[model samples]
Target: MKTVPIQIALPEDEYADQLAFLKKWDDGPKPPGWELTPKAVVVFICGGSGLRLENNQRMDIAPKFIGDRSLVERCVVTLAGARGLLLVGEPGTAKSMLSELLSAAICGTSALTVQGSAGTTEDQLRYGWNYGMLLAEGPSEKALVPSPVLSAMRAGKVARIEEITRCQPEIQDSLVPVLSERRIAVPELGDYSVPAREGFCVIATANLRDRGVSEMSAALKRRFNFEHVDPIADKKAEVALVKSRTQRAIADAQALIDVDDAVVDTLVTIFKDLRSGITEEGWSVAKPTTVMSTAEAVAISTSISLAAAYFPDSGAQLALIPGHILGAVRKDDEKDTERIIAYFDKAIQRRANANPNSPWAILWDNRHGIS
Candidate 1:
């Protein structure tokens, strides 16, 4: 069974449902050519409940990123004002997802995107010539291959640049003029240029934690409004996100949805503990080397449930394997082993001891062998 990428874009029928899920945007003015008002886009991206589509159907577009609605609101407003929107955050914080959802909702397509990397050249963000056509026709318009940004500009839609910081500063600065002047110049063919249409905009995402990231210049930054996305923090919100994500994962994995509530709680606890460096009981645990992101938690929980369903002994009890948890927590760093072990011994072990039949007790007893 092939799994499809989760569709973040809401169908027109689902637009109002999506609005209902987001916060009510009371912002002053809206951008041109937006499907929803700037305020509605904010509400759709962040978790809020005041929007409605013309159709009487109750739409249900879930808030994908569990962060502050205000932050999302600012991003929408920035795009509404035709300023570039830069989403900067740690890895796996859903920066790209948020950007994709925003672009898809705003422009009706998320496919017009540039994935930035160290090898990415100016041609990627700007325009490239089709070498075959260029050789045949000598730099005619037919030879010009417009990049995603140029296409978006001509079409008056949002263009997405993923991992903008991963591109070299030189490649990134190519957008300074496109953003500021709202046009791309092609000097090779008689100074041909594509001026942006009314609704044209750019949404770029960068990982702040990447080691080789090139900082955005102040001049370039001035062309955009930056939004920092934090990881999901509230327990109830995190649980809801995990549950929603796990359902999607299970559907994608083609696995049975036989996971237990206790198992969900346990996975959430591990994520919260490792992410925040404290247990649910407020016991401090050393930070692990791994990121402990909500995304990872959803993956681990889904994997455990699938393993239990397919494998013999593991499948019967629906019990989480300590080995799976250990593998999830103790990634990349040797020191993480000690941190995970400490967490299990001091926090999980203590809790399981108080309630002998606790679902985590099996995990607590088997932690050593698994690690």
Candidate 2:
């Protein structure tokens, strides 16, 4: 039987070449158990100009995270100092992606991860036991099953906690001792404890919108250096990111359609207007309750492209924008539908009237899709 490739590849596996090249490119001093120096790690995330290596070969490091270089530096510094790094941001601001890239760059792998959720338990953060082995061998090492955090501690690598706010407060507090003392006490085994190796640290992400679900305790909060990951502020940058991601997504689907830059620009404009509750022309618009993030823009762009690819007779790609926008906005609140309709009535209608040749005109023509 032929083995199939995974739909999504981990950062470590997907960027193995870049990692290896960085290791050889920068031989500067690295912190304990770190794969790349702090400078190289920053370059890996924020990107750098082409570098001429000692071997006369040129390599260009692509920017993975489109945000502040200083922010990435702070994240690296926090990890180097052996403190927990907490990334807080809106839902689609790429906080989790930043965490993965940081872990992959610092350690050799980004597989040590704990997905936080309402159903998450302390055992998933600390450790668990193999019931069959526990029944036979009692609380011996053979019976103990290490969690991702424990595995990272034992291996001297970085561990990631995704959506930490989604986890119960008590369950989230299980890391207090681990972060402060850098060790986990195994009460089941007398006098046995797992001490975090040199370079063992944690990176956690929490959505700002999920604050009320489970707030971190003061002790836990104090142990981590919080960094806010904001949305891409530059219009050109956001459009480029959306187009790049959309092309990648379309390629993943094995589709041959070319992504229309004009269509993507129009899509991103609508998202930005709806997200910020203001148009580029300084007109105020009603905002949707749901987040209109760059990630969602990419998704809608990819959907438009794929729809055009799979169904040639589905009209122009620009015509699909309004319906996709409606689908994206109406997720959380039903009132968002009225807000989107108002946006179409005011902003989109004005743009369509101003330029009949523009993509916005097509979106305006298809505005009925929202209703």
Candidate 3:
């Protein structure tokens, strides 16, 4: 019996077995380096709630995104069709997570990733020479160190470039031809080049908020089909996301912290108000410079739960919510505090009126006490 790869992040080991067992299956031909076809990639990631595995294991892979199912389907299709995919969104949107999931599901390895940063170099995008070996021996294939992108091409697998915009524009542009030509040319090595295998593709992510840092060149932009992953805005969706994420966080922490719905509601409300820069009633307020993302909300809520569990008497109530919200919002400007205060008074105060147990209200009452 063949064992499934252990590196796959899905809770299940053999997704193929899970797919077959879950009868809701119709898959196209698998690509050169992919375990499943484009269609199966969709079903695998989105999950099959009613499907069953061979050993009676249900396909319990929970849906990751709260957005349109069609968008996910489209992304999978785009990748399967060999088109380069670019997932652009604000900070904390699940672009990285989504890329990892897709890479794992399709190529059976999500480790082939290049993290974009200010110091990222062309060697990272293409291939780097083992400098010691290169100095000892002339420019030879033996001295060449293949980057994740090159390895992905040679292996016919998907390569992920995260925070593509964070890399300098020139460095980021190096991927344009690798995407369009689907090959990386190395004139120094020999009269040969690295030709991408049949299933090779690039999945890059960019942050809209980091637009000015290192913009993706127009040519590079033209090489990808962009998909913007937005934050989950609906209260119900946001609540579900936060609850699930918080639960996982607690589980990871090995702590028995139970976050009630009231707490979850308060956290979601604060995140939404601060993100949208307006009350639920459409009253406009000054917006903060910091990013109020769902990821941050999950993190903040998890912290609050741990605090409540460990120090129940520390007065971690609605009053504490503002401080947490303030820390998350006041990133680049002091003006954000005024906006946060306005939101607390207009939106949070009203919410507290409706729900007296709101943790944010405690923060509002003790606003002056917070630094």
lDDT of 2 by residue, 1-371 (tens): 99997998999899998889899899999999999999999998999888667997778988999989999999999999999999998889999899999999999888899999999999999999999988887899878899999999999999999999899988989999999999999999998999999889999999989864236888889999999999998999999999999999998999999999998888888888888888999999999999999999998999989999999999898888888988998899999999999999999899999999888888889988999
Report every candidate's CA lDDT. 0.77, 0.92, 0.77
Model 1: per-residue Cα lDDT over 164-256, one tens digit each: 888888788999999999999889988788899988999999887663334777778888788888888788888877777777777767777
TM-score of 2: 0.98
Ranking by TM-score: 2, 3, 1
Question: How many clashes in candidate 1?
Answer: 7
Instruction: Please list all clashing residue pairs in model 1, or write none if there are none.
Output: 16-53, 17-59, 21-48, 22-43, 22-48, 23-48, 308-315
Model 1 ranges with Cα > 4 A deviation:
1-30, 47-61, 212-214, 315-321
Please give each candidate's TM-score: 0.88, 0.98, 0.88
- Highest lDDT among the candidates is held by which one? 2
Cα deviation of 363, candidate 2, in Å: 1.3
Per-residue lDDT tens digits for candidate 3, residues 127-236, read 98988988888799888889999999999988999988889999988888888888889889777789999878889988888764235678887778988788876889
lDDT leaderboard ranking: 2, 3, 1
